[model samples]
Target: NSKPKDTQQSMCTPVCLGASGMVHVLLREELLLKEHILKTIILGQMLSLFICGTAVTSQYLAEQYQVNTPMFQSFINYSLLLLVYTTMLAFRTGSDSLWQILKQRWWKYIFLGLADVEANYMIVKAYQYTTLTSVQLLDCFGIPVLMALSWFILRARYRLIHFLAVAVCLLGVGTMVGADILAGRQDSEGSDVVIGDVLVLLGASLYAISNVSEEYIVKNLSRVEFLGMVGLFGTIISGLQLAIVEHREIMRIQWNWKIALLFTAFALCMFGLYSFMPVVIKVTSATSVNLGILTADLYSLFFGLFLFFYKFSGLYILSFVIIMVGFILYCSTPTRTAEPTALPQPGSTGLDNAALKLEENDSETPAITVQFTRGEAVVVSTD
Candidate 1:
């Protein structure tokens, strides 16, 4: 009888130990999730502050310094990226060399580079025609466009909570806009508000494209590759555009230490934005990054109070808080994995299917392949 009791006690001990271990694991996982959320929030705001820095510097250049060279400004940023990231990429050793990557995907990077370059130019140029606040707020237009692109192109699926969070963010934007109207600040510093708003919309759309592409590249490929390719193509494209569009403006600028410092500040801020953005996007979705950076407008307003002598509105504070709440809500939930979708099969010709299978198997090492035909299908296979 004592032996039976001893055996029962031994079994009970193992069960209790197993239960304790499971609880510990669950608690640790919960703590890790909370920590990750906190880190993402901090990183997102840092990016926002970097954006604010760029905006403030751009506005100062356009207003006080009378510098309206958008292409030239972007050119500097891209050149810096090329000088830094491209160089780093050259030294990186892996399955493919730098030349191999460029040879294989040069066209795709060109598209990305063009979109990125123009987006920066348009937003910076809008400062000449619109108030800083307008530029900041209108940029949110990209969020919806980004979501749509992600849904189709990136195969990202959103949850009901994500939609709710987005709604909350847009509501914050509405509150801010209302505040701008109440404060009689809508037309302030804006020469042609309509034109500026239109430019912002166009730029925001382009930004959505660039961001979604970046998200895909960084997640599937390498962050260094994305930055390096963007840098290389971006520098070349921006340089050509700058020569055609802003050469005269660049020549006419009255050079001074103050002006030089502002330009340097802008380039550094932009470089920082580009370098760190991939890290954030890799951890979170492009949509979350865009939403997180919405606070950039408030940061700009805070600076504008001192620099532009803008009037303060309480609604702006409320808007900022609301946006933060929405961002937190969105980040609390993990992004869903890309849902499986039907891939386009080979054409009626058996040759196409045979060739596709061969290519797919060859590229299996990287686990991603881009089909140039059939609407540029991206097939990702994982182990």
Candidate 2:
């Protein structure tokens, strides 16, 4: 028993203790961030604004251009998205050789592409069957749904206060949607709000899934590879779909300069927004990222009111406030657990240590001796 304790202590020192020390600091920083009411409020506002604005722009493009093909729209959206992310990666992953960048983990791109592609397609299809406001109502559900998934499936932990905050924010958002629907502001004639909601729900679900998947992927992949692959794959899928579905319409339509400018602007906005989102997530917590984006609703609201002249009932205001509150609550309540770092086992050479040594030496060195607690030792050399 005494010997076992000694061995345990020896193994625990650098591995467990060191790990705990580093993690404790990180956890503290995360907690400190949580305590700051100002940070959460500011971040939430920013995120919401961006989200709203982007939605408005998207809806405007769809309506003005009368683009009917869901797949084609998704393709175009992603093509632009790919370009944006690529440029971001170039700056973020500076000095990484192109070959090396390609070699980096790429599952992230796949996940992003899949989520985005599905979201885009679902949105376009939903719009065909419903109104922009209706589609938005359904789409906004993604935030809460995302929280639930993150909590249960991802096993992310949160405090009670955080949950309460999320509830408030979600309630506000719900109010807004309810208000819109009750005011006879649903999508155009022949478009089913029910179907649109369902489609949007599906799209939201996919988006939520992608968020979780992105966390894991980001841990392994470089930004370049992640976004590059997404752009490349999404472009291919969208292009094929466009070729089959929109070829005739595209050829017949007049290429107005205004339309071209709008499309370019839309593409640029999308690429830039998405490209920056991950960086924001990395710099802060997902909660901050989500809540900060709550302004998206407000942006949409203003767009609907002014740019599109979309009418809303008093109920719309109530619903919007409720949903916004709910979102705030949702974001305020932490759902994701900080990822724990893997530590080397007793008697095992640390991967980090080995890599550092190799980088420094770059030589065929003699065998490095590794000893066990029982006084037994073994030597393994490296090339």
Candidate 3:
């Protein structure tokens, strides 16, 4: 008597009942993970646009309404974010230690806050003395500073390609800055060029330090935890500084709905920017984040076209496109050297031979083979 037909076939073969389904499931998971990465990058870019645009709009409104106290803006922005996150922390469960973590690592956040404040202050203060040309030129030094810190402090490994990518990015930035200078942009605002240039340079360095600290925190702590800590410190530190420095000036400024709305929008964007930064760091790095932000100047130019009717330089447009190319070149390609998972080689062990036989009886999926080539692991898939 013949057995039931379902029982007659070999269960291990490619045509078995469940083999194709298993492969489909595995492939689906891989696809979903790739999709997640794509989504994150897109979201990060959108958030960046919001951050830069809103910040520019806020500054424009401040100038319009004669709001002279910038530090007050920073104080309110940090305070609002702190309150929001603190509320969130209250509702969330199973979070990392709030106060305890701060006690352990408070200095880092405090320093980050100070660096953030000082960088903004220095750049704003620089405008009182330096030409816009010098400020724009010196600001780019952050990239090199960040990369150096990443290499030395974070122990990041880099290759020649990485250096080339950074060079292309910086070259693109230099082109844009040079175009502004050659275009004979009006500088009716600067007073002491040398002192302001030095301040801008120092500000760029402080910005790099803050960015590195951000990357470090993102790598160690959860996004919520880090944001809460930063907001708490930023509000306290900036509030105290603002009170001492701008107490009289803030009282003189006109408080109106337009100013209030602009301030609210600015605060929201700051919150969004800080919140999304950790996700970007998780997806890529501080270097890539800086690269993405290199486009902010381009966005500012576009916004200026609408508001200020500034003459659009074809050279500036070309430089921006070049920067985009460099950013895409740096990001779209996987920079990490692939660590080939070493598969069992032929004749390495008796079980490896048995495994090959079993593989043949199984699905048509290729067998993974590993070989060492030039001290690097190379993996080959053989059917």
Number of the top-ranking candidate, with TM-score as the measure = 1
Q: Report residue 260 deviation for candidate 2 (angstroms).
A: 1.8
Q: Candidate 2, residues 245-341: lDDT per residue as tens digits?
A: 7788677656688767766665655666656566555555555466556557656776788788877567656655665555555554445464544
* lDDT, candidates in the order shown: 0.87, 0.62, 0.73
Q: What are the TM-scores, per candidate, against the unseen true structure? A: 0.84, 0.67, 0.75
Off by over 4 Å in 2: 1-37, 62-65, 69-77, 80-108, 130-134, 148-155, 188-197, 219-222, 291-294, 312-383
Model 1, range 216-330, lDDT digits (tens) per residue? 9999998888889999999999999988988999999999999999999999999999999999999888999999998887898899999999888999999999998999899
Write candidate 3's Cα lDDT for 127-199 as tens digits: 7798877787788888889988887766666667667777887888888877776767646557778899899
Q: 1 or 3: which has the higher TM-score?
A: 1
Model 1 stretches astray by more than 4 angstroms: 92-95, 127-137, 188-195, 339-383
The lDDT-based order of candidates, best leading, equals 1, 3, 2
| TM-score for predicted model 2 compared with the true structure | 0.67
Between prediction 1 and prediction 2, the one with superior lDDT is: 1
